[model samples]
Target: LAPQPKAPPSPPAPQALELPPNASPVLSSGPSPPPAPKASQPPPSGPSPPTAPKAAPPPPPPSKSGGPLPPPPALPGSSKTRPPPLMKSGNKTDTDEDSSEAKTKLKPFFWDKVATNANKSMVWDHLKAGSFQLSEDAIETLFGCNADKKSGDAKKDIASKEAAQVVRILDPKKAQNLAISLKALSVSAEEVSCAVKEGNELPSDLIQTLIRWVPSTDEELRLRLYTGELSQLGPAEQFLKAIFDIPYIYERLDALLFMAGLPEETSNVKQSFATLEMACEELKNSRLFLKLLEAVLKTGNRMNVGTFRGGAQAFKLDTLLKLSDVKGTDGKITLLHFVVQEMIHSEGVRSARAAKEQTGSVSSVDNNDLIEEEYKQLGLQAVSSLGDELQNVRNAAILDADQLAMSVASVVHRLGKTKEFLNTSMKSLDEDSGFHRKLVHFVEQSQTDVTFLLEEEKKIRSLVKSTVDYFHGRTGKDEGLRLFVVVRDFLAMLDKVCNEVKEASKVTPKKTKTEFPHTQVFSRSPA
Candidate 1:
């Protein structure tokens, strides 16, 4: 009965309200929107209102007017510069620190950092700063220290020996080939590294060899080993530590080696410079020899005047070979004999004139007869004088021009190498240090010297070519042989003629046969 009474009062049953076509559902005041569908129900199929993607939770409300919130305070013990986290390849979460660390690990080796002898000087400086311990095996391996020796500075002696070896290795002048020695050192270092990695001790002899070859001090060697940058060098750090344990020992040894290397290099540079200068002087002071060439050219022009190929501005030096082809009616005599004869005759005229002046007396003797006697006496002497004047020319022309040029080039090359050595080696020294300043000065001076030498070499080369061309020497074909060989053969022929003249002068002249008066008169009347 109570339910019936409540049902009578029950409100009209709720019904769905339809919106007019022109009325918006929002504007239409309809029963409150049907209770939102339960979460488990699907959304209605009819076109639903478009929804935006959920925005990132609105940034925390600004804490101040018109300004964004400040960053949250760091937690206790948190660093502002956090260490980078480890990352896998292709990881998107990697931080800059991680990227930088990866790049560092992937960096390639720079052999130039340690390969140069200059770096060894830097190593010495580091060693002087402190003492470090060396393992027993290292001492035996590098310094050849006897394992049984537990007393009496035996280690010191071994270190001294090793130091000596290092000096010899670093000084290029001591090595037959500097490049080869350096290469061998690099290979040995690699071998030592491999042996160490294999857990086998490097051969003592090999270690000794390396120690001898390596310019770096034992301390630097140890430090490099510790860093593993020299990983391939096997227990190098240990060996270095053992050898340089004594305080100030490596310092002294480094100084000694540096001083030792200096003298040899200095001497080599000086000697090379001296050689170049001497060669340059010889070329510059060869004026007399050049005049001799001019004289020869003049003589040749006069002999060939008015003929084809005559009055030549230049003569092929090879023409000297032809001088012997022209002989007198006497088959034994050649043009060289005539040339010598003329030279002797000229010398006699001068000699007789000088004698007359000295005597202040005019002898009743015919000057012509006196000149002939003088010619006989001066023949050998004139030949000797000619030889003396020709000696310089012969020396200049006979030298192996190619060899001399090559020697000059070699000196220049060596000088360049020495300059590079000084520049690189002195870099480790303080700019204000005496050695550094000295090296810089030497290098500068050497540069000037080298420039001057190069200029002189150019001049010499030009002179030699001009001389060859002036001689009317052989042209295109056999030109090289013509320059020297022709002149050399000519000088040889001249000497032979002088010898012949000397022998003739030693002999008595044969008397001429006299014709009877009738026979002589009849011979003259006919022709």
Candidate 2:
């Protein structure tokens, strides 16, 4: 068999650190990436004598891509001084290639020693595992006032205790420094809780700072922790628990949920108001319905001409409901039936003539067709139609405007109450301070958002009351539900009657050319 080349010598074994069992590196044994540029510089390349490969450390498991992991990175401040280049036979040309090879051979040993030292320093454990404990000096700096005092239960006692204990423990400047260090070390929430418990009361500044620094203490976690009444807590945890205890916190939460629905509520009101305005405008201004009403009034007058009810000056809108109650002598059809028949016949006469005059041909006019053409001209077709527009109005009208207004007003009131409580109880949150400034900005913005549609709402409010009064109804603090029902039923009945008239007209026969000779005369005379 052909001779096989011996396997290349292994890379050097890395030096290991001596650590307590519990304090060993928490970082993964797999190789890490290169250290930052500022920590280490790459070595210069040159040639030197060839050297055997240094021994390699235990190989990392094959990566997902089927290669071994790279070596762990050198730590910051762990780089070694580069030695002078090696020479071979005192010739520059011969030494150039060999120098590069020798440099590669020696590099692993130096890096192994540097990495071992870095692991011994335990900085990696602190940064990677977030296991850094508060030093004695840091603890002393935070709570080092050498005195103890007792607090009383009465008003004076509470004041004295808060003044002595809470104030001294929460020095703003020291707390800020501590927060900076904790952030740098990537301290865990448990560590933060422990640190806070060591100090009795949390300063408003600290609370504000920590909220930004530690976003992990989310609303859900805060609620879960605060809701548990039997759990033992540190002073910091207790302070956090107390902050949540503020009644306004619950109020604020409820307000947020309510605010979520405000957009849809506001949209419904605006759209409903627009629809009602359109429908009412058509009812007030359309001439077709007016003419129809006049015909009905004439019928009523003729019916009661010899009676005491004859020649009425004006009739209430409620009179429309009584038309069905007034039956003919046959008792099979009511006054409403006669009225609808008259309206449909009128539509046929007027529309057939107009069609002959416009088209100059009686053959083009179908007297049996519904008065849809006249309806279009009088704008009554759109008024009688009910779809999303009617629904929009109903949705708006059914809303408890007073309740919505009260809910919004309540939130505004609570904001003011919270501001007062904060000012009176925590006097430490100075008006000019960052926390106070941010808080004021928030309140102002909230008030603006809550009251954005107030003016439009006021106009709609008055309009709604007027609508009720117009219908001879009243809705005292009921958000117009009764008023809306009346309007809804009235419009629905009108639509049904209009539909009936149209359907009845469809079965009526067409006016033939022989029946109307006026169209032939007009067509011949026209230029």
**Candidate achieving the largest lDDT:** 2
Query: Against the unseen true structure, what C-alpha lDDT does each candidate score?
Result: 0.47, 0.49
lDDT of 1 by residue, 390-477 (tens): 4545555545556655755665675566565555543443244444454456556656755665666676565555555554543443
> Ten-residue segment with the worst summed lDDT in candidate 1?
518-527
Error in Å for residue 206 of model 2: 27
294-403: candidate 2 lDDT, tens digit per residue: 65677777778899998865554557667768787888666776665455445445544665778766564444553444523333343344323455444544556567
lDDT of 1 at 493: 76
Off by over 4 Å in 2: 1-255, 258-276, 352-442, 449-452, 464-484, 497-527
